[model samples]
Target: MVDLYTHILPNVEKGPRDVNAFLTMAKSLVDQGVKNVVASPTYNGQDLEKQNIMLYVEAANKHLQHAFIPLTILPGQKVTIHYRLIQAFEQNVHLPINHSTKYMFLQLPNENTDVLNEQILYELQLKGIVPIINEPERHPTFLEDSDLLYEIVKRGAIVQLSSDSIVGKNGRKEKKAALTFIDKGLAHIIASGVCADTYESYTLPKAYDMVSRQFGTQILYKFMENADYIVEGKAIFKEQPERVKKGKFLGIF
Candidate 1:
């Protein structure tokens, strides 16, 4: 399974202890049996925004060589916001992406609606780049107004929810929002936004199980197809099961 998003700092190589700490954290994810992890650099509140993304990408690749089969680089939002985001579109030039990479991951401001985010996505689409937004539910504004989620999907952005949100690790509200979006068919993928060793948080496989039980096994495939198409630059939803889950269950008498 492909666990989508994580924040592996680039400056971890600053010292021996730092390198060891990062490897230990990364290996823990591998120990949990993840096949591949797509990671982006964090940039919530920092002076060195996008300063360490390149290093993070390099670190992910290095760790993946020994831990997983296919290491995917989720271009941190700092990279997107600072450069490479609207470059070709803004300049009207055709540029080829790095030979090894295909997709870019971005984070939204906690307080903005999907409108500005859509503009960014449209710019990316115009430039022929597929942008995947990370953890939309974590955005305070998005949570306050769920309809924005549907609107974002209406535009060309794929929404990734954290695994912890899926199984109620974040809270009942987060879990409900996540499931509601899934039920409405808005959310496209589940990523393990792992920060540290926390047993209460949902792992990728466990989240998959919970989603399968709540929705269906077929939705899982649809989610994967969404990720694949975005990375592959496809503009259509992959063919899916015609039958959608119906008939809610009630507690036993």
Candidate 2:
């Protein structure tokens, strides 16, 4: 499965010791059967953070062109697109894309979001860029406003649900919200936003398997296949044969 979201800090030195902490974390995932991972930088880092991201992007792009299952780098950050981003755009500091990098992974604030978030997405759309909000389950405000979530998808923004939510790693509240979104067909993708132990933690294969066992294989497969599409930059739509109700489970497959 393609892990659509991850964080891997680059190693500045050579060999294994040269890489950052997250690389060691990611190495564990590789041992667990995760073939591809789309990684990005953390919100905070020191010098050459941008350069590190670029290195990952450039390297991955070259490998992907040859069908090599190299770890892919999405490179965009979690921070808001403020003066710095705008200035970078003005100076063309961002990586040039070819109809693909149009999709960006946005990390929303863990707490409630204001109208500015909506504006940020709107502006991104205006620039022909689609914002894929990561881990909506962590944001309580989103669960409180399902209509707003629907609106975001309606306006062409995609929601990425974390795989751990199904197994309750994110806590009961996040699990419930994730189920709500999936049962209602509001979620289009599920990724193991795993940091460490690729084999043990954030392993999509195991997490989804457990979910399939409990929730039935159909629900699990729906998210599994949809996850593939999201990584390929395909648009996923809500697929419900009937209306969804709270506290009720729907057949997902």
Candidate 3:
């Protein structure tokens, strides 16, 4: 499977600290049956950071070949939804998934506001970039108001749900939200490596098996296909998202 979000690059978020640490983390993903992973460091719109991301991706891929590891690491970032991201894009930085200018992973903080909400996403869409927001299931703002996410999805943003969250590794609230997103057709992709601190390396694979059992293969296959498309830089399949009731379970068991 393809993991669209990971911090396997050193100095990129809390993935790994050094080359050795990176290998160790990558090995964990390999052991979990993940063949490809996108390295998502926390980007802040700097040319130097872009260079470093490219540098680490090349170096890490070489190391994988030299060490006989079969896993491939793709280049990507979990860019914070700052206003400057607009300027950065205008300046020619392709903050996209797997180096593809079509899709990009843009993250919103807990305290999301108007700037982080509709405006930037609309702007990105105007440029033909489909912004993929990671783990809205765990965001306090989104949890408090599920319609917020529906509105964003209606505006053309894709949702990437965290596997561990759906696996109930984060907490009950996160689990409920994660499953609800899938039930409502809001989630377009599933991935791991939200953070090294919450790393239960096996949960991603476990989540797939368990979710496929509980929710059926239709939902499972859609997100899985979307992951592959993101890596390949092609258009992904998105369901017509159904709006969620404020306090109901939304049919998610």
Best by TM-score: 3
In model 3, pairs of residues that clash are none
What does the lDDT read for residue 140 in candidate 2?
69
Each prediction's number of clashing residue pairs: 0, 4, 0
lDDT of 2 by residue, 109-138 (tens): 555455666777787778877777777777
- The residue-by-residue lDDT of candidate 1 on 76-148, one tens digit each, is 3323333344653355222222213445666776446445667777777776666666776666766666666
Candidate 2: clashing pairs of residues: 11-19, 28-198, 29-198, 29-199
lDDT of 3 by residue, 183-210 (tens): 8888898888645554555577778886
User: Once model 3 is optimally superposed onto the true structure by TM-score, how far is the C-alpha of residue 73 displaced, in angstroms?
Assistant: 0.7
Output the lDDT of residue 196, model 1: 43
Candidate 3 stretches greater than 4 Å from native? 45-48, 194-200, 249-252
lDDT to native, each model: 0.56, 0.59, 0.80
Error of 1 at 154 (Å): 1.1
Give per-model CA RMSD. 6.0, 5.4, 2.1
Q: Estimate each model's TM-score.
A: 0.71, 0.71, 0.92
